[model samples]
Target chain A: MHYIEVQKKDFNVGYEYQQLVKDNSSDGAVVFFVGRMREFNQGQKVSALTLEHYPGMTEKLLAKIEAEAQERWPLEDSLIIHRYGRMEPGEQIVLVVTASAHRKAAFEACEFLIDWLKTKAPFWKSEETAEGTKWVEAKASDDQAADKWSEK
Target chain B: MITVLFFASLKEQLGCNGISLSGAGINTINDIKQSLIADKPDWSKWLHKPNLLCAKNCEVVNGDCSVTSGDEVAFFPPVTGG
Candidate 1:
């Protein structure tokens, strides 16, 4: 099973995890990750962040990324829930869950999913800082992180 | 006509979200860019950025990709989502 969601409303991680594991006894290992908004970025104090995305394209690319992960690993199930719109510091921004019969596949696939989503997804962030609002730039480190997966 | 869309900072920089252009001579994504720059000389800097990304009908594509009437083309910067 695979699920992909892009919405403005926040998601409940516990509820999503239960849904992922429900009636699925075959998978022995499950791994999940949650990304949150932080208060500081690039040495500036950020009060809130507004996320914007290409509506139709965002969902399509996310599905493609999840399918790519399934092709590369023996995944029993996976879930990707990413939130957009205005959010305050410490709020959950994204969630990734992966389940497999073995720990290695579960762990690696979970990491791979998030890594690819970071660079491939069509979402941009603008931060509201003490000084003013600023658009977040794509980090080279993030591109490098996503690129590493292609080598393996 | 073809629809040209811009996202995030590009939209703000261009002060426009989308526009429609007659498909007459618009053959490729680059052609659209050229047309846009011709109309608004100030947009050349942002539209011609080296790292600017392009997509056709919601799928990322090269700027040289073929385009035709009724296609939706998008231009944006590198993604920063996770």
Candidate 2:
């Protein structure tokens, strides 16, 4: 099973993990990732953040990322959850879970999903900082991270 | 007509979330961008920024990609979400 969602409601990580591994007795490992809003970024104190996305495009690209991960790994199941709208520091922003028959595949696929999601997804973020609210630009480091997976 | 969308800083800077352009002579993403600049001269700076990204029909695409009527095109600053 593969699950992907975008919503304003906060998610329960434990509940999501449970759902990821349920009814998959053959899977021996489950790796999940949760991304949270940071209090500081690029030398600025971030008090809050607002995330926006191209609604139809965001879901479509996420599903494509999940499909790519499934093809690259022996994944039994995977789930992706991303939140939008206003949020404060320490709040959950995104979650990714990958279940597989072994720990390595589960771990690698989980990381892959996050890496691809960073550069491929349509979501954009703006933070409330001490200076003022500003849009977050894509980082070169993120592109490098995603590029690593492309190396044959 | 081809639908165009903007997000994040571009959305705020352009002062519009989206717009529609006639498909005629709007074969490439760059063509539509030029048309936008012609109509809204004030948006030239942000619209022409080096980091601007484009997508056609929900798929990330280059400026040279073809666009047609009924297509949904989007332009935004490079993504920053996780």
Query: Using TM-score as the measure, which candidate wins?
Result: 1
lDDT of all predictions, in order shown? 0.93, 0.91
Residue A118 error for model 2, in Å? 0.6
Candidate 2 ranges beyond 4 A from true positions: none
DockQ, all models: 0.90, 0.91
lDDT of 2 by residue, A18-59 (tens): 766566688899887999999989888999999999899999
Candidate 1 on A22-126: residue-level lDDT in tens? 888999999989999999998889999999999999999999999999999999999999999999999999999999999999999999999999998999999
TM-score of chain A for the candidates in order shown? 0.98, 0.97
In model 1, what lDDT does residue B27 have? 93
Error of 2 at A43 (Å): 3.0
TM-scores vs. true structure, each candidate: 0.98, 0.97
